[model samples]
Target chain A: MSDDIRKKVFEIIAEQAVLEVSEIAPEHSPQDLGLDSLALVESIFAIEEAFGIEVPFNANAPQQGDFDISSIAAIAAAVERLVAEQRGA
Target chain B: MRRVVITGAGTINPLGHSVSETLAAMRAGRSAIGPLEIRDAGRLSVRIGAQVRDYVAEEHFSRQQLGLYDRFTQFALLAAAEALAQSGLPFPDGRTERAGVVLGTAGGGVGTWDESYRAVYEEGRNRVHPFVVPRLMNNAAAGHVSMRWNLKGPSFSVATACASSNHAMGLAAQMIRAGQAEVMLAGGSEAMLCFGGIKAWEGLRVMSRQACRPFSADRDGMVQGEGAAVFVFEEYEHARTRGAEILAEVAGFAMTSDAADIVMPSREGAARALAGALADAGLAPEQIGYINAHGTGTAANDRTECAAVADVFGAHAGRLMISSTKSMHGHLIGGTGAVELLACIMALREGVIAPTVGYRAPDPECPLDVVPNTAREARVEAVLSNAFAFGGFNAVLALRRA
Candidate 1:
């Protein structure tokens, strides 16, 4: 389940960045991958749609969100946790 | 004080997609207002609108650009591109740093908002598009234009309902006259012909279902339109130095407020704006030969505007050739004045007066010489473009032959 979530996360970010999934490194932040504010927001939206789970991200203050977005790995782990919690509920 | 002149003009209204096409349509006295073309047309009471037909998003913008640009921003950018190309004043070296963009739009991205809201409420969707906020904001059009042209100077958007474009053009001219910017891309755009946009206006009952017959006794109400018009307002000296083809001189502009009813038209406010514009231009009433009236085709606005024109021009009102191009293009709301200014420019530059196309019978309340249903060939030295908004906001601009 976590692997599936990770793969989906990288695909979504790659789509937003207009890059191949292989090009997106797990350690790289969205900015390091040339993802603008618009791209980041779209990635978040796509993640929510794919997982059917809401990610606590605010466009006005993106860094203050509960979901960690420091790197692609962090975003993937956050989505995994949210999906697990939703399944348990 | 510096002088400002229109170096270039571009528009995409119902009449035409280009300035040249629009001019030809005006000369032929063609009506662009026709059957509505929007989603859920069967549900709307006001089905007709003057929409930009056959507009394909992919043809005008890239996929990346389409993600950020709403229909209104697209219209503005397209119009601005044409205007800039016509001006031929390339922002070379550091000249781009001092140029700016000022636009007027009442609904900005109302289409985006309406679609997103419908998704959540009507379609029972939980998530909306991520770029919805940025796309729907009122300043989106202005911001996109500034970014596209690399205009780093003063940039903003105005929302004065129907008078928005007049206020924007007037303020842009003042920026040039005050020496704040060497050049300013000024105009307005609107894309409020969507289901939600028309539904909201239907409540006001100021919509004409059939035709927009301004100043005619059988006039019912206004027909909505969606499009844009943009112009290059440059300092006269700068344009002259560049040997740019000057379109027309933006002689003067004035704005006034009634401070009365929010929805009703004010003769006092309109008259004051007309008088103030002439005074600002330092031209007597007799010097002005034509007027492009607000003429919303609504009974109240047509009557009030005519009374105000008579009050200000008096005897000259009878001699001046006054007509409403809105009769052909339909009311573009916030963007209406910018498109109507084309009529004034045509009058001054081409010596062609665009006629009010759908005139049936004139009412005594509006007794001015409305050039009815036929374009007139006349060598007018100066012209006035009037715009009156719902909140008693009035803005009038004067232009002269280059």
Candidate 2:
């Protein structure tokens, strides 16, 4: 289920943004993936709306070092964590 | 200085072809937005646009004549014909040499470009259509209007992204004021509801998957629309002499540049333009009854425009009837303000205000009362039409009852 959700999430990001998931790895931040602050907010909205899960919003979730939203792997992991939280809740 | 007034109006929008048809559609709250019918829209996430359907060049122009014109040019010719018919102004005879034509367009001949590129890149065709350059030129519409009407004076086109038509009207007004022409055919035309056009807008990242819902909290982004709206502007005396039915006076206009950013809007820039237009019209904010907003259904634009309105009108901003007709017509880009200006003229003359179609929820950031979803009846005095373009080109025009 998380993988399927991740696939959808990656599709939206791939369609909207120029960077690819493989291009940005575990080391790169989402910002480095070129999801500007605004795009990040919008992406967050799209993800939550798409997956029916709320991302755990730590004050620094957006501020973590080298957060890579460009890579499908990173986005899937983030989405997986969020989905787990929603289910745990 | 001479005065300028709208002596005639014409349109071919998603609603219909005539001015009355479009106005009726707006009053009925019927949005012209629908599924794309032009090309293979399968790849696009957003598959809707306000397309002018069944508009065939062969039906309107002869093949030989059509060879010299693009879709934009054909639309301009038809719209100008309608405007001239409404104005009951025959070609000005020898005096036609003094009449001018100014048109606004953003995409020019984007359809032609798209087809040519496909032929060369995908089909590997070595030869392109010879009409490509003439058809694709941004000034083709103006040139066609000039040729169709025998207009000779000060003919040109102005392009300032979405603000194109408002700028054209402002310039036309100035030309009339300066006695450069006795009559001017002014407005804008766009036929960019093509594959290439939509692809170009995709790069902007602001297009909504659903319909445009300007000033709505749930609004995603703008829907593309295609059409032309033209106005016959004449010196007050010339129109009166010809017994033409005057619509609304081009009372005053103002323009400003943001100089801040290419894409983002500035409240300071918008406020200055709004204030300048009011000042130019020699009217106070309280006297203005309606405003056609440049609400592009984007988060940034609506909030910025709302804040700018609040900053300028204070409490009166709430009282003023404001709506973004783009909700119904979609964003015509360069032609939007011109077509929307027609709505303003209709409101002033008929004493009714059109509503912002597709407006559902109230946006917290955009606190303005955008006459939501339903057309309202009011004795409007003056209307202001605002257009803010991509590169921070801001233009405001104040139209009053003639």
Candidate 2 Cα errors over 4 Å, as ranges: A1-89, B92-94
lDDT of 2 by residue, B21-41 (tens): 888888888898999986779
* Span of 10 residues, lowest total lDDT, candidate 2 chain B: B200-209
Return the top candidate by TM-score.
2
Candidate 1 residue pairs that clash: none
In order, how many clashes per candidate? 0, 9
Model 1 stretches with alpha carbons more than 4 Å out? A1-89, B92-94
Writing each residue's lDDT as its tens digit, candidate 1 over B314-386 gives 8889999999999888999989999999999999989999999899997999999899999999999999999
lDDT of 1 at A27: 97
What's the residue-level lDDT of B248 in candidate 1?
A: 93
What are the clashing pairs of model 2? A21-A71, A21-A72, A28-A66, A29-A66, A29-A67, A29-A68, A30-A67, A30-A68, A30-A69
